[model samples]
Target: MRAVVYDAPGAFSVREVPVPEPGPGEVRLAVEMAGMCGTDVHIDAGGFFSRYPLTPGHEIVGRVDALGDGVTSLARGEPVVADNTVLCGHCAPCRRGEPLFCANFYSLGVNGPGGFADCVVVRAEKCFAAGDLDLGTAVMAEPTACVVHGLDVLDLRPGADVLVFGAGPTGLVLAQLLAHGGAARVTVAAPTARKLDLARSYGTDVTVEIDRSDPARALPVLRAAAPDGYDVVVDATGAASVVEICLGLVRDGGTFFVYGMADEQLSVPLHPYEVFRRELTIKGSFAQTHCFERSLALLRSGRVRTDGLVTHEFALGDYGLALEATRSDRSCVKAAVVP
Candidate 1:
């Protein structure tokens, strides 16, 4: 089977590889549609860690082509989505019920060969029945699950006013979940007017176009939209500059969530005095944490729109162009690889 393999940093190829088969307590997925995410871009650029010659895709939707021994709970030929977390139960973090931070943490897409192939072998427990939706929509299940985890860390209060940075796929999903979590007002800020319009269609109360290079001008327009400040302010741009600027936009007692994946080498300054004086809560959310079922339900119910989110998709052979669309195209919110 042909799989997208990252040979080294800034290098990849769709090479023919052996088809994976299910092992005990495992299941083999026949790749249908896999979502290309920001993390994939980072991995390609050598910013994130990954085993070279890796099949890089975590957000996946496919059918159960085969099931391994002790995997009777699922049926053959059933459509499904795979969870990427693979935790060693004995690890301290797992024992503490926080597998996302396991001392020996590994994920399917990032740590090993994952969904970007004709077939992938995953633990049976990690495969959930695909929601009652088309492949394109079901592909969002993984990322949506991560968004649910972000909300988990946030502990949102009802009727809270919220402002989010970046109107990309993750930011837009965050906006919808905030609305569902009972936030009274939700505003999304991004560099693109097209995405801001997309956010509005998803029921965002306000949308602001931001020019990160000129925060002096953009910040004022954003501040005027909510003069009192917001109960929750989030940076989803994953840009160090944006994250640093978003710190001062939260209300005195409000919280700030770092929902974006910034480069590890980047650093920003924070004022300790202000944090002490205002009682601000700054938190960061990582990968999906066992939220697949609820996320799939929301997507299946049409509460979260998938219409414009998947702006581009390519066949397995066109993987090169697909990667380019993700980086060079500002209009491309999300791209998928269909096999």
Candidate 2:
């Protein structure tokens, strides 16, 4: 087997490594495709505390090559995707129904070996049949699951006006979910015209081009798109600077959902009294949890499409180039490593 291994922070190498076999209750998957995300970039740059000497890809899809003892639900050569985050079921948070914050939480590609290799092994229960879903699109299951979790946090009313920031892959997926979940109108604001154009194709009713040099210039346009203010305002840019802007767009008594993975040390200046006065709901949505199945079902039903979203790909050996492209290439909606 061959794998992309991170020896340490700011270091990596692709080399021939021994193929791993599944332990009991696990299955080995021949890596088909693994989607690259901002998290991978973070992991590469030492921005995350992921255990090193690792194979860093979480958005993965592969064909089952072998199943371990007691694995009866799956068979060899079945296409599948798995939940990478491993939780200790008896943790205090898990018992509290908050396993996302479990006391002992770890994940593949982060805390353990992952995709980004010719083959990877995972727990059998974590694997889901990718039934007829294209491998490239199946890689979106993790992200879509995150978006579904965000939607769960929203608990929104049907037919409400919505405003979304950013138009990247996740932004577009969020838009589609909002539309399908019954948002009367969904508007997407992004700096890139091409992405906005693609957002339109994803059913966003309006797109606003924000000038990076002067983002405030788009405020009037966004306001005009929702003259009465939006029932829900979402920030998917993952930039701290955009938080206040999205907060301002939320209507009184409306929800402002922070779905972006902003800088950890970043802080926003928000007035407590304002929130108290407006009775506003400000929420933060984190990683995917218990939403993978529905995410796959959405792909199966054709409610979410990735034809225009997966714009770039690289081979396993070109991992560095893939990261560079993800950072510099605005045109690449979703970058994947096709093994």
The local distance difference test score of model 2 is 0.86
- List pairs with backbone clashes in candidate 2: none
Each candidate's lDDT (Cα)? 0.87, 0.86
Residue-wise C-alpha lDDT for candidate 2, range 1-339, written one tens digit per residue: 889999887699889999998999999999899988877887887665588788899888999999899999999999999888888899899999999887777878877898899999989988989958877789999989989998998987999999998887899999999999999989888888998998988778988888865667788988877776899999997776678787778888998998887766778899888789888899989886789989999988889877677888899999888888887788888889988
What TM-score does candidate 2 get on C-alpha atoms? 0.96
Which pairs of residues collide in candidate 1?
Answer: none
- Model 1 ranges with Cα > 4 A deviation: none
Error of 1 at 88 (Å): 1.3
lDDT agreement of model 1 with the native: 0.87
Top TM-score hit: 1
Give all candidate RMSDs, comma-separated: 1.3, 1.4
